[model samples]
Target: MIKNVEIRQALPADAPAIEALYPAAFPDEDLVPLVRDLQELAAISFVGLANNGLVAHAAFTPCSLAGRGDNVALLGPVAVAPDRQRQGIGSALLRAGLRHLQNAGTGWVFVLGDPGYYGCLGFKPDDDVRPPYRLPEEWRGAWQSLSLSEHKTPLRDQLTVPQAWRRQALWTPYGL
Candidate 1:
């Protein structure tokens, strides 16, 4: 396990380290452009550095409902270096990025991920809110949302995931 791990906003120099983690985390996927796009559009992106190098990273990108109804963000591709898994670095990076988004007045955040892990961080599936795309049965309960506004409004049934993310197959279920 790495000691003295520090979490901070991702820097331009951290791109290579961040890119390197993606393939290890999702080997079957082509993550080149996704990494580039996240770096470009992220409202908040964070990295955890250990003694050797970066060990974990997370990103949140701007998103909104169609017709410009409400503003939100998408949390995704949270990754930890292969050798660094289960050391709490991923959790730390996620918490830091989520806290930053909440403090920035972002009203809502959505994610498609493992419910077991994300649920512990206040992510939940609300039947009242649904994504724009069709998700698998198993994914329905995995789609989650977090509200940062003081007086939270019920999420619209029709989610409008960002257009740029729509082409990606992984985001199809979440309607990104």
Candidate 2:
């Protein structure tokens, strides 16, 4: 279990470490490029700094909502060091990142993640906002959203992720 996890904005110098993190965190998945490209594209990102190093990371990319005035972002590709998994470092880091986004006037944040895990972070199934590509029916519940604003407005629209996230494999509901 990690203590003294300081949450901070991910710096460019942290790229190397962040690149190494995903492969270790998800050995069977090639999530490094997703986050690396996102960072290069200036995605809103954060890191959990600990005595050892950056033990956790989370990145959110801006998304355009069709006909919606609200500012929205898509959260993904969060990673926690293998040893730090389930120690709450990832969750705390995510909470800190979410707070930063909320304070920055982000109206809502969407994530394609496990309902149980993200639900703890205030995300709910938002059938109104559809993903860029249609997700499998079995994975529909995996698409969720969390409102950062006080106003309970339904973010009803189609989500268009930034070019950095246009990879079809990233949107696939299977083999991952």
Candidate 3:
């Protein structure tokens, strides 16, 4: 557990700390572009700080379902300081960010993460709904969603990937 952790919206000043945590948490890939995308698309960014230094971060990006459209959000890039793993910092950051987005009028939120973790947070897969982006088979069951709106609506028959993200091969069928 961190000695003095605080959860709050991420600021421009937190970029460096956020950047540093990414490589430490994900050394297999360069995440600069993903980070930029999150900053550009998120309705809000959140961070956890300890001793005035960032220890965890998460982002909630604006998203929408095409055709049977509804305002939605995407959660991503949640990271915690390696030393602080399993300390509940990631959960705190996610809960705070989700609450903020819901209060700000986001109708739903989606995430591509471990279902076991997100399930505890009220996320579930819309097996009845399909997304345009072909997620990996293993991920299909993990592509969970949560609705914040009091009156739930049927999920769109199909989901649509943002045009910018559609080009990624990871979203293609074989790759998926």
In model 3, where is the ten-residue run with the lowest total lDDT? 167-176
Model 1 CA deviation exceeding 4 Å by range: 1-3, 172-176
TM-score for each candidate, following the candidate numbering: 0.87, 0.93, 0.85
Best by TM-score: 2
Clashing pairs in 2: none
lDDT of 1: 0.77
In order, the Cα lDDT scores of the candidates are: 0.77, 0.86, 0.74
Write one digit per residue (lDDT tens) for candidate 3, span 128-169.
Answer: 566656776777867778988898886765656554345454
Worst 10 residues of 2 by lDDT: 167-176
Off by over 4 Å in 2: 67-69, 173-176
Select the stronger candidate by TM-score from 1 and 3.
Answer: 1
Write model 1 residue lDDT over 1-176, tens digit each, in one string. 23689889988989988898888877877666777877776446888988858888888878776647577888877888888898888887888887888887889888887788888888888576666667777778778988878888877755666555666475643312
Put down candidate 2 lDDT per residue, 29-145, tens digits, no spaces: 898778878988899999988885988899988887974555899998898998988989888888988999999999889998888889999899889999988888988989999
